[model samples]
Target: MEMIEMNTRERRRMTLMTRVAEGLLKLRMAAEMLVVSYRQAKRIWRRYREEGDVGLVRRGRGRSSNRTRPAAERKRAVALYVKQYGGFGPLLASEHLASDHGIKVDHETLRRWLLSAGLWASRRRREAHRAARERRPRRGDLVQIDGSEHDWFEGRGPRVVLMVMIDDATNKTLARFYEGEDTAAAYDIFDRYVCQEGLPVALYPDRDSIYVCTREACLEEELANVGPETQFARAMRELGVGLILAHSPQAKGRVERRHGLFQDRLVKEMRLLGIRTLVAANAYLDGTFLALVNARYTVKARDPTNGHQTRPTTATLALVLSWQEPRTVAKDWTLCWRNHRLQIDARHAALGLPGRRVVVAERRNGTLAILHNKRLLTFRNAPAPAAPRLRPAAPQAPHLTRRPPAADHPWRRSALIHRPVFCPPPTSYTAHSRGAENRAAATPSRAVPTT
Candidate 1:
């Protein structure tokens, strides 16, 4: 007797065939129970009767799938991945394999191979329960912007921040590398996005101080019924673009999720290409990486109409997307900013700039412009005021000489032991009596009785 292995389905079919052969069930009834055609059931019954239990098993059960790649091909893919694409996720690795190495393999298949080869570890995902939010209806309706600071160069260079802007509706992404996440980075990335894709209807960003003013309102601002606005916020308002602040990281889940993806995929891609500087990283981002990401991840918006307005002119954009502050011109036609005095051109002094408010705009290129009545004014760096000169000390009066007393002078003797006493003559008898009593009081032991 030989042992046979069969799945539950196969065992059930075998029992059913035995009953049909014993006349306990009819072929038609068996066919109905098995949910198969009468002809197929007849074939199964015939095979079972002629070949016993062995014939009841499926024919292709233990054989390799016809679509499975050869062992040599699988080995090559795994080797290539370990050598060149290590640390890449299966999906990204498969994409590179197909595009770069001319190896076509499904990501799922590659994932299994990597797991079996111990090149990848399975990750347990803990997805929090949150209500799903639908994407916007048209492209450029809402864009999500955020910065991700990471070791983007993998210790080869200084760590930098990648400022990412992703469209809420289509998932189109724009990104650039900066030294830090600041107003300057925000302006640069937004300026590029607007120029390339036009002005979006609104921007969705986390409540970072770069995007929202976190400072408390001052008394003056409160009394004016106004609140402080960040430079980025002010620029957006001037461009007629709405600014929506996400209360939590989850509120802008799309961009947050994008950060995770880029941290994984973009980091690896940059490492492979040896991108270790901001300029090279940004060049690659603009030229290649962004296009690839958009092509792979972007989807058609529900509505075909573009929600973006036309982009502003270059000069207009530069003026709007700058750090602007209102400064009052002094009597000397000079403006003080950041401890530097900017002397207004004498030509513009004819415009009566004294005691008037003008906007001082610090442009992205580190240039400063003074704007009055929407017109640019020429200015130069005023020389710092000369240090005060020290005055000479006043002449001192001549010192006075002093004379010393003789050693035996009366001033050196004690008055209690060496002083003389004098008595005044009385003017009347009653006065004489008072004086005598006074003398008596002064010399208690010599008191005289008055009768």
Candidate 2:
């Protein structure tokens, strides 16, 4: 009986209705899966036949529905919101309308209106989550750090970026810095996190070039593992911080989701509450915002044993992460770097080793520190002994002060002479004569005159 009823609609696509008609299907299962009426399915089939894929498209293809505000006005409002209020959603826009535009609407009602008007995510497709993130057991065990560029304030200011570090186990934001996205920002953020929250056992972060580096093409083997070590990663490693690479954003969904709340609620609230400056934002975050947010969501156990240990001092870490190259000291206790000879006062009896092999750690930015017996002996940015490039020598011949001979002289090359190979035909007059003789023959002979 149910199968006969389903025969009413002609389904072109592989909907459950068509599935049942094509083969075997239980009535209950078909009813559950096939939500469309039989007639609707037939319409879909008819549309497919008539217009192919075009007819099968969902209704109101290009044009928006009536509920949407006028294009110019909606765009104006959206622009205003973005500029003035940091791009709040329709619901948040209601406050703006009342305060500035003099048009007031309920937040929920505005959301529906925006949806009906086709301005909201009702039309946006959902992205699939890829990886599973297993948060560490302890609060201080692991922290996921990332940067987000957002209009923290409405349009009152320029776009600002936040470097956020959130603890894995407790979902607590340990530290936040408002700065542009870059390696320096990450380093500064790391430095602050260390001072404030102490060093976490591990860090889960996205792969950025600064945290990694690439080597030359020919020397692939030499630089095979030349990963992110512009500076920040090196410092982190020096501090004995664990680095975990996340293949996809979904792998760090905890931070990803936090970013969403930050973009939506926290950003909007900042605008409404008039938090403009980074210092102000930092103050607000410290007061209670982060604590409340963490308490609400970070419902996980803190790692029993605090994962952090003492921060390896700068001198020690320098040996570990610095760019190292082997070198030997001279008899006079001097080292060579380019043309500059770096002389350290090892001659004093206080120190040991008169002659020994040592390592040179050259900083990418500046300064060269020497290491002996795993201890940094002296530091100096020695002058380069020779330029990396050698200038080409002028021809070995001697130079004469006087000018050279003219072009006509033997020493000088022959004077360049060129002739026109093809001349254009005469257009003004018909050319019958090759020379004066032909012209004389054509006209009355000048014989009398010649006589």
Candidate 3:
């Protein structure tokens, strides 16, 4: 007897057919149990009775699928992948194979082939558990923004930072490449986003110093009893958009995950396109890559309503999104900014521009302007102050001549040789005693003390 392989369903059917053959269960009941049509059950019963348990096994077993690719095609795909697309994930490699090589293989099918060929290893990551947060209900309600510093060019060019903004509701994204993650990059990307999609109601950003002022309050700010604010924050406030700072990268995980995806797909895409510079990368990003990403990733929001405000005018945007600081005009109608003296135009001199505060704005285009009460003021670069001249040193005084003292001068005489001499009488014992008595009699004694 030949051993036949049968799955659980076949074995179960065989048991049911055995019972039906014994008249223990009706064929109709067996058909109901197997959830098959009565006609199909009858055919199965007839076949089982005629050919035994072996016939219950599926005939298609041990036969290749009709949908399977030809051996030559499989070998060719594997060869192409090994030669040119090594290290690419199965899905990405399959896409490239389809688009570039005309090999139409499903990513899942290609994954199995790669695994079997030992070209790709399966990765099973144990992800940390996180509570899922529901997305905002409307598009433009909250946009998550982040900067990913990456070797985006795969050693073909310098490493760059990719600034990305993604909608929390729809996953719609906008991105740009910059040399570094700085205030200027943030401003530029944000400006483009606002200009294109209008202003989102709220922005979600990490607690980077570019998005939030992480510095301790300065003396002036402390005296004013206010917290420090970054230029980005100030711009958002001026535009009436809320700035929500995420305490952790996970808080804005939408954009963070987008960064990961870009680092994978965008890097490979650029590498394939031979994009080796920031300018070319950004051009490809805006022109083609962004559209592809948004089309694939964006989904319909719960609410179809748009939460973005109307886009502001170009002038308004330039003014609001600029680096602005207050400068006090001096008595000469001049203000010092970044160590350059800016003289207020003479036409404005009659307006008493001196001793007034004006905003010195450095726009994104590297142009400077002075605005007083939201009006642009004309100004010119003041000439540098002239260096002071040093006075000549005073004429030197004439040299003095010294005279030597005379040899016979008083200053040169010895004191011992010029002194006068004195003589005294010689003392005797009898004369000494009489002199002492005479001196005692002549001096009155103080006898009142005894009395």
Candidate 4:
């Protein structure tokens, strides 16, 4: 009875001694070696001393509580959860789990269970994920990409799409545009990226077709191992840049966040600048708005690789990347862009070959650049004429106001000659009075002789 009744304090000390002196020394030495964690270790030994070996057993081990649920019920609830709300978070899930399915569980508890079953979003994962993303090791490693479709002219003109590429490490917008949302338009963005920002190591973009092409296109190594030959892709291929596709918008959330900022500030900027045409807005975008936006939104780079593979050389870019179709200057020294013939500005005669084929570099924001044999032409904007209005046509006279012919006049109606107002012969031909007319004419001649 005394052995079983060993005091809590003494038993804890004995347990501590057992652990610390397993290889070292006597009980006193062991006790002394129990370190600063001695309070916890001592308490455990004390419990065992008071209640025998049974005290060492867990406090809540054997008997189930009144409020505890059946294992079978939790299993069933998890099944229902996965089927109905596969991707939803736990707090939203718990309400449905309880009210509809009659499974009562705290959200945290449910979260842990779901995690064990591989059904929960990992909070720790999200935290570590954000941290890693926030710490890009190099500036040129990743570029954030997205497309914005809006009426840039605020209903004063056509709606255009703007494809944007911003640096992930520095958050600087390298290029943007006004175009229709299509692969062609996306290539325009890619072209700008090549020229302005140089080749990026990787581009982070949403799963739009431009970023990912079709599945067939992706698996086209056998048929088209040649890589992209489209103007934009060709440039990237030469520079060895890569494209990374995001399955969800949230995956490339940096570009999405930048979009939100642009919506708020860009709209206000347009309003302040009185931008009503695509032309003017694009000018502002390329020039003044750019500097302003970069100043405000560009965060300092997390890594210091400077984000540029190379400052593109005009000579190299010209040789490597083919742009618009080659056109020759006419004898009159005129070049053509779809019928708008241009004169080689006198200042650019330094290019030597007036009749040689030269490449025209058409940019995304509707700007045309002419590169002669080697030198580039500085173009002056051509003045356009104002729209002409149509003149109102002369009024025509009404038909009722015109003069009538003689037959239509009531006064001359009887002059329409009829053959002796001929009366119809009744059912047979009637012999006329030729003899009576001869007798009457003879009587009239005799009367005239007497007169």
Candidate 5:
């Protein structure tokens, strides 16, 4: 006989039926014990007598579920997910499934299916309360900016830094991959953002040295011109854009969150397209990826008014956004840059440029400009000396002949070898020989030889 598995409730009813069959318990009493009606108890008791404990087992036990999906359909979905949407989260994959393949599945159901099939792992989300930050009123009212340094190519190419700016109100994002996150790169990023969306009302960024100068000397200098500002900050000041420095990264959480999203989805997308270089990646972003991301993620602003104002002309923008440094021209009418001397033209003699300080402007497109009092100067490039000239090679040393020693000199004296005054005593052999000689002398010349 096949054994039947029964739950606690079923076993209890079977136990009560056994007592009823033994004639110890009445039918009404068994019904009361099992919490069932008297008629139902009578039927259960009869079935127990005929079929034993098996009759208490549920009839639907060990049977397939009525709402189960077909094996073929499940296998098809799992195969598609593993092949194409492996990195996608469950809800995103479910959306793609319905949109692309007519597979109408609930997100939780698909998540469970993926989990059971070993295609997806569940992530436990942290539940910590943060300070609430309301979005701005207009699209360009406030922009949050940050740089994410990542190995975006996953070893397919060199690692790079991605400069990202997101509108706090509309969630609009502008990003470009760069070699580093420095003042020059930040200036280029702002230049691009301004050309497209005009000047924002304010920019929110971290207190990086590229964005703000924290040095004591720099703070002192800020007393004169822009206060405690870096080169990038000065450019923004010239553009009439306000900046808000975040004390903590969470203060500008919008761009930080977008960085996480890009590191995940953008990396995979670039991998699929074999985009390794920064140029190709940026082009892909401008042409296709940006539109896709904005459409999927952006939201309407609270206020309908556009906060971005009109930008300045291209020439002014270039001048304001460039890297400028003040240098004093040397006696040779040259200024040094990157170890190369920029020689001002002789024609500038009319301007009397020697020993005068001029501002050197380094443009983003790899061009150099020298300006004195806001007037452009013509200059040529030459290799600058690595070190200052030394004294003359020291004066040549005078040579002299050596003099020979005379006969009366100390070298003509007789040399002496000093010896120890006292000799060391000999061992047992020498003492014994002396004693033998004394004994022989005491014995007198017993054997005097004629020779």
Candidate 6:
């Protein structure tokens, strides 16, 4: 007798059908045991009589699936993956193959081929448990802002920090590449965003020093009626924009995940384009990359209304978005700031401005403005050596001197001396009135004496 290899279920079914065919068991009993209909069992029973155990095997077993790709195609795809797209994930590789290489295949199909061909490795990522937060209802309702320091040029150029601003509602993205991540870069990028998208209702950022001040004094302010703030925070407050600082990176996961996506896609794209500088990268981003990113990732907002307000005027923005500090005007109407002595106008000092506190606004464009009582004061750069000097008038002719009053004058009658004592002015000031006036005009506010 010939022996055939079969699994337990097939052997059992075969035995029952054989018994039925041999008249040792009823068809209904055979069907019941084999879990098949009597009609199906009868069919099996007839096949068993002629073919014996051969018919017991599954019909499609050991046969190539009709859905399988051709052997030649599979081999070609694996070779292409290994040679060209070895570092790309299955989804990205599949996209390139379909669009660039004229090859049509499902991502999973390509993935399996790459895996079997040892061109790619599989990684299982554990899903993180997080409380889902619904997106804001309207565009610009909440703008998530973050800076990602990365090699965006992917070794084609220097590393740069990409400052990204994403609308929480629509996922619309605005980004720029900078040399580094700092307060100035943040200000510049945000200023550009405001111009492009208007003022967002609120900003969501992590607790970086640029976004939040962590000093003890700042914390004290938080406990007081005043909240702790940084330059960026202060600017937002001045602009009437709300701030929501994330305690952890996961709190603002949208921007964080975007950073990761940008690092992968943007780097590869810049590499392909041979972009090597921040200016070129930013130009490409604003013109072309931004629209592509938005069209691909953005979704409709829950509400149709836009939350952004009209952008502030340039002058208003210059005042509010600048770095401001309260500085006291020196007695001479000079403001010492950033190692430069700025001399306020003598007219301002004549208005009793000495020792008064003024706000020094350092604009993003490297210009400075001195504001007192919300009004801008005129100032000039006063270098130490070139500062205004007080020089007295030259001595005048003796004829210019007036004669002393007579001893019998009423001013001397009850005086301590026979004649009213005339105290000579300092030698620095001569008897020449015109020369004295000119010297006084040139003197610094401190050097000018009051009568």
Which 10 residues in a row give candidate 5 its minimum summed lDDT? 411-420
The Cα local distance difference test for each model comes to 0.90, 0.65, 0.90, 0.66, 0.85, 0.84
The sequence of per-residue lDDT tens digits that candidate 6 reaches over residues 231-329 is 888899878889898988889989998898788777766765789987899889888888888999999998999899778999989778888887887
Model 2 compared with the native: what TM-score?
A: 0.50
Comparing 1 and 5 by lDDT, which wins? 1
| Residue-by-residue lDDT tens digits, candidate 2, 26-51 | 43555445566656656655665676
| Model 5 per-residue lDDT tens digits across residues 324-416 | 888989988988977778889998898887777898988778788998888888888866567976777777778877898777766655322
Better of 4 and 5 by TM-score: 5
lDDT of 1: 0.90
For model 4, how does the per-residue alpha-carbon lDDT over 340-442 read when each residue is reduced to its tens digit? 7666677766666567777676654456777765467876544343579989988987768666666677556656644267677644223336566667788
lDDT of 4 at 181: 66
- By TM-score, the better pick of 1 and 4 is 1
lDDT of 3 by residue, 217-331 (tens): 8886788575799998989988889998888777788898898899888888887789999899888987999999999999999999999998889988997889999899998
Q: List candidate 6 segments past 4 Å from native.
A: 1-58, 218-228, 346-351, 382-451
Best by TM-score: 1
Alpha carbon RMSD to native, model 1? 9.8
Predictions: Cα RMSD each: 9.8, 16.6, 11.8, 17.7, 9.4, 24.9
Q: List the residue pairs that clash in candidate 6.
A: none
